[model samples]
Structures are given as C-alpha cells and as structure tokens.
Target: MLVYVVATALAVLFTYISVVYDKTLKDSLQKSRYVYLKPRIDVWQKLTLYVLRVASVLPLVLVAGFRYKVGTDWGNYLRSFRSVTHGKDGHYGEKGYRFIQKFVAFFTSNYIWLFLLCAIIFAGFYFVGIYKMSINPPLSVALIVATSIYFSFLNGMRQGLAQAILFFSLRYVFKRDWKRFLIFVLLASSFHKSSLVFLIVYILYGFKIDIKRIIFYIVIFGMVGLAGGQLVKYVVMKTKYAHYYMSAFADGGFEWLWFFISTAILVVMCCYYENGQKSELKGQFNVLLWMQMISVIFCLISATVPESNRIVWMFNIGQILSLPILISLEKDKRWRLVLLVLILGFYMLATYIAIRGGSHRVLPYRMSFGGE
Candidate 1:
C-alpha cells in the first residue's frame, strides 16, 4: 500500500512539472521552427501538447502499479546483501553484485520490509529518469521506463541500484557529456561489477567507427566467447546459488534470434537516416543501441556454452533510450500508434510466457500482483 502511494505521488508530481516547465522550452523550439522553414505552432497548441505528454505518463504508472512483477528479483536482492556482508569483501571477489543487499540487510533482515524498501528504491530510479527529462519532452522518459523489462525486473535488478544510476548516466550521455558518463559508470560499478562494461561505450560512441575499430569489436566479441568459459566458472564457484548457472535460459533458440534482429533494425535505422537525422537521434540512440548490440553479441557466442542465460538482462540496457528515439523519429501518427501497441504487446506476451514457464516455482513469500 505504501508502495502504491509513493508511486502515485511521484507520477503526479512528474506530470505536473513537465506540463508547467515546457512553455518556456517550447518557445525556443518554436522560434527555431520559424527561423527554419516551418510556421510556428501556436503557444496554445504547444501547451496542449505539453498536457498530453504529461497525461501520457500516468498510464505507465498505472500499469506498473497494477502488476509489479516481484518474484525472482526479491530473491536476488537478498543474495546481493549476503554477498557483500556475510563474508570477506566477498562481493568484489565474487565478480557479481552483492552490495545493495548488504545495505538493506543492515536495516531489517525481514524479507517483507526489504521488498517494500526495494520497490521504493526502484520507483525513485524511475522518477529520476523523469526528472532528468523535465528540461525537454518528459513523456519520453516516463514512457520508456513504463514499458521496460528493466522496470518489470526491478525486484531482481534492484540489487544494487544500477538502473537508477544508469538512467541518470544516460541523461548525462544524452547531453553529450562524457565526464558525467564516466562518473556515473564508476559509481554504478561500486554496486555491480558487470556495470563496468558500460564504460567501454566510449570505444564505440567516442570515435567515428573506423575499419580498425570494427575489426577490434569483432576481435573482442570472439575473445568474449573464448574467455566466457573461464569467467562463468569463476563466478559460479565464487558466487552463492551458483548452480543456478546450469539451468538454461528458456529464451535461448528462436527468441534469442529476435534479439539480433532488433539490433540489426536499429543499426539500419542509423544508416538509413540522413546525417542530420542521425545526429538528432544519436543523442539517445548511439550509446544504447551499441550497448544492446554488444550485449546480445556477447551472450550469443560465449564459447563455454553453458546455460548462462543471466547475460540476457543486459538487453534491457537499450529500452530507456530506444523507446524515445523511436517515438521522436516516427513521423506518422498511425504508424506511431501501431508501433506502440506492438511494443507493448510484445513485452506483455513475452513476460507472460516467461512467468508461465516458471509457474511451478515457489517463492518463500508469494506477494502476488496477479502475474500468475
């Protein structure tokens, strides 16, 4: 109940702020539009558009509030604490995250209290993304968070506050500030080591893609596959419940293929767009697209070839940035609505199938939100 209240309050506050702030910002855009080739959209019309954008954020809150998936994430959260606290600097040595779990455990070892706290933490992350967007079109941030598997998996992913921090880092990256990106990535690594991979983004986003860099990326991918076996072995032995490694990710074969297809499409979007259009969207798409592409490539080729589906979570790295890029670029309203429905439906179906596959699995405490 407290979770619902907090989520509701944040949603209302974000929507109100976005609507109120846009008048000044849109005036600049309207001036540019007139200076360019187009007639200015009137102030009244722009304000109405602002209201609609603000209004759009509400549904996401409603949906996430209605069916917050609180399963496996909760378990991961407890283990995160155990990894950091119970043993010798174990979290760092383990190569996986155990930091936030330890922090939460400090307050109350009780699972119920821990869950409410986690929900609050994730909601805070969700809003931070919205707050960052208040300077521009804010609906984009809210919509992306609302539709993301990242948001859905907050229970598991919330172990160390990576999503919240990552969103803030993304805000910086969108602004073209490499320094802030470095700072956020460093901070994120303190919580989860896997986040270190995010720092490599400059290698992709920093320089113009030369033929050599492409070759380097290819070589890196191959090395990841070759090194994957040793790395997985190390994490499994060092980390708790490591045997969960043997269970194959259910989305391995065909579902796995779709991931590559998604990456290919985004790359094509980059290539097909004019240099100016690409420049406009690059603010959001460049880092995210490469991150998802690299993440999928790594998961697909790992030579150890054990049942290491955990790597798939890396794909959600693209969701926050990609949604807004697609929304902002898509010119046709009907087509935009179609894509929105398709994206939402795809996640709904995918999530339902995944949860159903694990239906027989039992939780220590079933705080159901009708996801069964």
Candidate 2:
C-alpha cells in the first residue's frame, strides 16, 4: 500500500519536473542537441536527443514496468483468449469471440513480446503526435503519455494502443486528410472496435464550439438518454457490435459521470479563452465536445454498461492531455498553474482509486474478453 502511494507521488513529481525541463532545456543547448526526428539533424544533435529522452524516460519506464509486472488483468485477458479459442465462452458474453479468436492467436506464440511491441508502438504514436502538433516537443509529451495509469496499470492496452493512433490521427483530422484519418481509424478499430466513436469525433471541427453549441450537445445528450436502450438494442441485434450492447448496456455505469464534470470544465475553459484562446484549445474544445457526447450516449444505451467507463476514459485521455497542453500554451502563468494542479490532481485521484479498489479487476485497462 505504502509502495503504491509513494511511487505514484514520485511519478507525478518526476513528470512535473520533466515537463519543465523540456520547456527550458533548449536554451542551454545548441540547435544540434535539440532536434531528434529530422533526418538532417546532426549526429551530435541526435545523440543529445537520445540522452535527453533516456534521462526522462528511464525512471518512467521503471515505474510503468512495476505496474505491468503487478498487473492482474493481463492474466485474465489470456484466459479469455484461451476460452474463446477452445470453444468456451469468455468473460464479456458474446461481444468479441470471433474477433478475439481470429487475431489473438498470436498471443499463444509469444504474448509477452507482442505486448511489448504494442507498448513501444503506442509510445511512438503518442510522442510523435503530441510533440509535433503541440508546442512542447516529443520528450515532454513522451514522459506524460508514458504515465498513463489506465494504459500501464488498469490494463487498457487495447484502448491505450487505439488512443495512440487517435492521437496521431488528429493531425490528419485537422488537415481534413480524410483518407489518412480513415486509415488510422480503421487500424485503431482493429485494436478495439469502440474507437469507431472517433469516426464521429474526427470531423467534429466542422461544427463550431460555443455556448449555443454546448447547449445543443446537452440537449442531444438528454434526448439520447431518453432513447438509449432501444437504440442500442436495435444496433446490437443488427450489427457486429451487437455484443457490445450486452455487457456495456447492462452495466449501468453511472460512475462514468466524471466525463460530465470534465465536459463542464472544458466548456468553462473554452469560454475563458474564447476571445483570447489559442488555436489548439479551440480544436480540443471541439474534440471534448465530441468525446462528451460519445460517452454520455454510450452510457445511456448500454443494457449493463460494463465497458462504458472504459469508453468514457478513452475520451478522457484525449481531453486530459490535449486540453491542459493547450492551456499551457496560452502563455498565462496563472492558468498554467491552475491547469497543472487539475491535471496532477486528476491523475493522482485515479491512481489512488485504482490502488484502493475493492473490486480492483474493474479498472479500465483490464479489458475482459468474455466472448459469448
């Protein structure tokens, strides 16, 4: 117990320092030491870049590995895979039996290595996307993205991996690069079909985000809540996601209201920066608007709603990282400090809840594959 608390506190502090370093460290070095991804960057620059990343990432790696090593969910995931393949049902009823049996056979050959490969792939997508599009470079974003407690501990590997691609796909979305964005979305959906929600999200900028629009979304949310169960039932009976409605709708996951609070915060933030807002915040405002809608609608519809929280979190991850970064880029020190507190506070609460969890298996990262 003490171990988890101390480790989480240290992780949070270390992340704060790493982000500060990323902002200021450039002034101390020549241009050669700063650029890492550019092919034409000098050898000295590349080496320095690697050293910097190593310095920041090494500790995060150690802590993250600890979480994974203590991971209980991975074992269950393997069990679900085993059952689904052997003609037995898995934990999630009948949601993904066919899909799991198809590709997850790779797990039998070398599951651990495959997991590692996925972790690395997610890391690459996270760092490049956040850094390239964001004002902060990749190192800082890499440090932040690595500490995804849901990704590392709750065993949200599939969603984690999908969100990584979503992180990258946002660039294409911004560019209206529909082809590339669709390609990325297809890849993400292969990891976890729920990421198909982002399909609606990808083009959300088409609608402006404002108070009137926010009210409109709230109205839509209420309407969906009214009609949720039947709509879900219809879709489930008709489509592959039929199984999705089974556990997800049955779960009655009202706990996912954290997304509602986050949505409220985002609306406030958008209003705060309305005239003075940065472009990224405006973009993220639209993004949050989409996420909030997706989360609320899904929760309303699911019969049980077992995975609704996880899906809400799928949306939360984008809001948490992108909104604060945009706030940081606002050049208002006061807003920066406040945003820092909220980000730190939110993750700390998440870590503590997960650690103290009574039914700890319920963590978002631990995807159960009860393939009915």
Candidate 3:
C-alpha cells in the first residue's frame, strides 16, 4: 500500500513538472535568443517533455501489469491463458483480446506477458488521450488515480483496452471525421463488443439540443432502467456473450451514485463556462456534455443490470477529460486553485473508500517478479 501511494505520488509530481515545462516552452518561444541556443533549448525541452510523459505513465503500467493475485480477475485470466490451445478456433474473448492471448501463449506461454501487453496498450492510449485532450494534464492524471479507474483497468482488461482505444478515437469524433471515428470504434469493438455503443456519439457530436430536451431523454432512460435487467437478459440470450451474463451478477445499486454526482458537477461547470467564458472550445464542451448525459443514463441503467458497471464505465471515462477541461476554463487563478483543491480532496476521500471497499479487489498488492 505504501509503495502504491508513493509511486502514484511520484507520477503526479513528475506530471505536474512536465506541465510546468510546457508553460516554460511557450513563454520561451516568444523571447528573442541566439538562433543556435534557441533550437538547442527547444529540442531539450521537447525531449524532457517526452521523458516526463513516459515517467507519468510508467508507475501505473508497472504496478498494474506486474501484479500477481491483485485484481479480482487475475486468477481467471491466468487459468484462461493456460487452458487456451494455440491456433485453435475459440471464442474465449473478443477477437482482439483472444489474439493477444494466443500471441502471448504461442511464444512464452507466460500470463505475465499478457498482462504487460494489455497494460502497455491501455496506458499508452490513455495517457496519450489525456495529454492531447485535457487542458490540465496533471489534474486529469490525479483524477484518474483518485477515481481508481486505473486500478479498475487491471481487472477489466478487455474493456479497459477498448476504452483506451475509444479514448484516442474521441479526437476524430470532435473533428467530425466520421470515417476515422468509425474505423477506430470498430477496432475498439474488436476488443470489447460494448464499445460499439460509442458509435452513437458521432451523431450526438455537433447536434444542438437544449438542456430541457436532454432532461427529457434522461427521464425516458430512467423509465427503461425499471426493466433494465430483463431487457439485458433478453438481448444477451441471443448473443454469444450470453455466458458472461448467464448467472445473475450482483446489482451495482448505489455503487455508481458518485458517477452521477460527478457528472452533474461537470455539467454545471461546463454550462457555467459556456454561458460566461465564451471560449473557442465550446464545441468540445458540448461534446463532453452529451457524453456526460449518456454516462448518467448508463449509470442509472446499471442499477438494475448486473455487471453493467462495465458498460457504465464506457461513458463515465469521459470524466477524465471533461473535469480537467472544465477546470481549465476558469480564468481566475484563485478560483481555479480552489476548485482543484476541492476536487482533489473529494477524489482522495473517494479513492480511499474505493480501495477499502473491496469491490475492485485490488488491495494487498502483489508482484509477479518475485516469488508469489
């Protein structure tokens, strides 16, 4: 536990330093300097930025990937990997995940490699998205840690992979590049079929809808939630993924209430910014707003549908970017600082509960490098 906390603190510190370097680079670019010295300084800053980015993600990848009996699914994944026959037709997981398992099994037959590869894929995409889309990268990174979403990824490997893929694809969604967006979403779906649900985002990207109308949609979704379990059962029964839902998993119930509260806060923040600040990123705010609404609906639906938290996360992951982006919109430095402190405080408390809550089963961290 101490190691985990220390590693996370180090990553957050390094990431903050990287953001400071970014500001320095911009400020330096406006200064007049000797041509030779300027280029050298620019190159050095860029290299430092790259290294810091790697440092920011390294702890998370190592901690998650090198785990032994940490995540709830660790044993299940290990057993599946060992039992899988190479070069055989099987529907063990989504095609992308199955291919990864097969590739790992064919060479070293080590489950460690499987975890490592998935960790790399997830961290690589997730960090890249945070760096590109977030206006406040440090805050975003901290939020991700505090939310325990990174730990969640260790357990839900397939869905994590898909979510990371979708994270990258969001840029195309914002750009309205339908072809690229569709391609990436399809790729993500190959990792987890539920990722296909993200395709609806393309239509919602730039569509103008008032908040009242959005509320109406939420009401309709709440009604659907009343029968969500039966609805899910009916659909799963006709799909190959039925086995996963065959046994009734425990209802998430109020487990997802925090997401709803966070989403509401984000919505309010974005609306405040949109109405007052008048930034150019208003379109991006709208996109995030719609995504938050969708996430809220999914959260409600998951209340009745067993194991639907997996689906809820697909939309909820938007918070990683949404919250940081909203915070960045504040022009007053003092207010920004206050918001950051409050959000961080809340996140710290939430993370403490999540880790101790045991639903994620990530406590008592173990490593595979040494004897298990």
**Candidate number of the best TM-score:** 3
lDDT tens readout by residue for model 2, 1-372: 444344434544544454565555465455545665332445776566555544543433443333432454566655665665566655532243235443555455334433445445565676557555665443234334333433342355566677778778887876778999999988888777877877876767687655556567666865765566566567666876566555434555455435445555555555554543445456655665566556555544333433556566566555534554545655678977776666556655654564457333423322221332
Better of 2 and 3 by lDDT: 3
Return the number of clashes found in candidate 3. Answer: 0
What is the full ranking by lDDT, best candidate first? 3, 2, 1
Candidate 1: list runs displaced more than 4 Å.
Answer: 1-69, 73-111, 133-155, 158-160, 176-179, 209-261, 264-268, 275-279, 302-312, 359-372
Candidate 3 lDDT over residue span 171-241, tens digit each: 88878899999999999999888899999888887687576677788779867875666877788778866
Off by over 4 Å in 3: 32-45, 84-91, 243-252, 270-273, 370-372
Worst lDDT window (10 residues) for model 2?
362-371
Residue by residue across 200-223, what tens digits does model 1's lDDT show? 665566644432354367568757
lDDT score of model 1?
0.51
The local distance difference test score of each candidate is 0.51, 0.54, 0.76
